[model samples]
Target: MTRILVTGGAGYIGSIATHMLLEAGYEVSVLDDLSTGHKDAIDTRARFVEGSILDSDALTAALSNCSAVMHFAGKSLVGESVEKPDLYMQVNVEGSTKLLDAMKVAGIKDIVFSSSAATYGQPGDAPISEQSPTKPTNPYGVTKLKVDELLASRAVTDGIAAVSLRYFNVAGALQTSDGWLAERHNPETHLIPNIFKATPSAPLQVFGTDWPTPDNTCIRDYVHVLDLIDGHISALSIMKPGTYQVLNLGSGSGYSVREVIDTASRVAGRVMPSVDVARRAGDPAVLVASIEKAKKVLNWSPKRDLNQIMQDVVSSGA
Candidate 1:
């Protein structure tokens, strides 16, 4: 069986990928510092290297006997990224370069990166294609775009085979023998989970009430975590040496903030209370992905919808 290195394998999406890869008969080695990921979330079937991607020795150890990498490790919170731009650069951009260097030394040429739709900041109403202009409004998006650029460059100069899956908002959970692998961020910022967490005293704060969207709230494309991972697996099969591709992973449709709140309320059989607030800095009014390229190239499309996402999250108790 081929061994694959999964960086940040203890986190929500990475953990699910690790589990699914194992189920698909791949030997996996997981590298994570447990900074944002959880040690318990790392699948016991895989070799676990508890260290950050920034550590060269850790990268070398994790890459051992691995034929390819599924790079999911990085600082991802947009608001936090705004506060600590330097941290985002050091970890996301610089750490990715280090991973590439380790890959070169280890003779592993294939990688599937966890990029974001944030790269196309404020690309309005229409679904964004891979060919869309990249104008990232936040440092988190900037770092992801930088890593994509690096991968493209490496593909040209170093014969690397890479596919960057530029994801929109990833939500929902995956079931496992141990339990549900779900979102467990310390300061939960995602919509679905936070919707469940909202109570009478601490209702979820709706970020912006006055965007130009139909609902007058920020609109975003959300893909279930399972569908997102499927895209990653499909990407692994289509990687061509000395070539790079960027594919957007999202539902073709979008949901406004209020729509999500209402959906959650309906799904949970209660009123999900929320209050309107001022717009966040660096927030795009709308971000929806055009998955046409992914559908044509990888032969993949999301099988789940926003309602299913909300239902799964509610059922998982995440």
Candidate 2:
């Protein structure tokens, strides 16, 4: 079996991808700091190395005998990034460069980088493609865009095969024979989980209703976590050397804040509460993905819809 190193493999998406990669017959080694990740979420079938990407000695030790790396390690809170831009650059940008330098010494040439759709900033159009302008507004998005550029440039000069999967809002969990992996970000910022946390009578704060969208609220695309994992495995199995690809993973459709809350209400069989609030700075009106390239390149398409996404999350009790 091909040995692969998965950074942040104890976190939400990384954990699921590690599980799937193990089941698919690869020898998986996970590198996580447990700073924001959970050890309980990691699969026992794979080897685990507890360390942050900043530790070069630990990274080199973990990279030994590995054929490829799936990088998902970084600080990633938009509001927090705004509060600490220096931290975002240091961790996301500087740490990634450290990983790349380590990979060079290790002679590992294959990688699948975790990027975010937030890199597109406040886009002028809906259904953004790979060619969309990458003017990230916040520190978090700026850092991810920097890593994408770093990986692309490395692929060109180093004969490395790397692909960056720019993800939209990721939701839901997967149930398997061993167990289920759920979204569990501390100080939870995800919409679905936060909605579940709200009481029926208490109002959930709906930020920004004065946008130019049809519902006058911000709109975004959400894809199931499992669907996003499928995209990773698809790219891992097919990418060739000396090539680079950037693809968007999302449901072709979008849901506004109002639409999401309404759907959550119907799905939970309760009236979800809401209080319209002021527009958040740098908040885009709509941010959906044009997954045509994803379908063509990864031979993948999202199978779950919003209702199923909410149902799965609720069922998982995440």
TM-scores for the candidates:
0.97, 0.96
- Which candidate number maximizes lDDT? 1
What is the TM-score (0 to 1) of candidate 1?
0.97
Model 2 TM = 0.96
**Can you tell me which runs of candidate 1 are displaced by over 4 Å?**
none
Question: Who wins the TM-score comparison?
Answer: 1
Candidate 1: pairs in clash: none
How accurate locally, in lDDT, is each candidate?
0.92, 0.89
Candidate 1, residues 1-318: lDDT per residue as tens digits?
899999999998999999999988999999999999998998899999999899999999999999999999999998999899999999999999999999999999999999998888877547899888999988999999999999999999999999999998999888898988899998888888898998889888988888888879988899999999888888889989999999999988889999999998998889998888888876778888899999999999899998999888988885
- lDDT, candidate 2, 191-239, per-residue tens: 8888888875767889988888888888889999888988998998767
Q: Candidate 1's error at 50, in angstroms?
A: 0.6
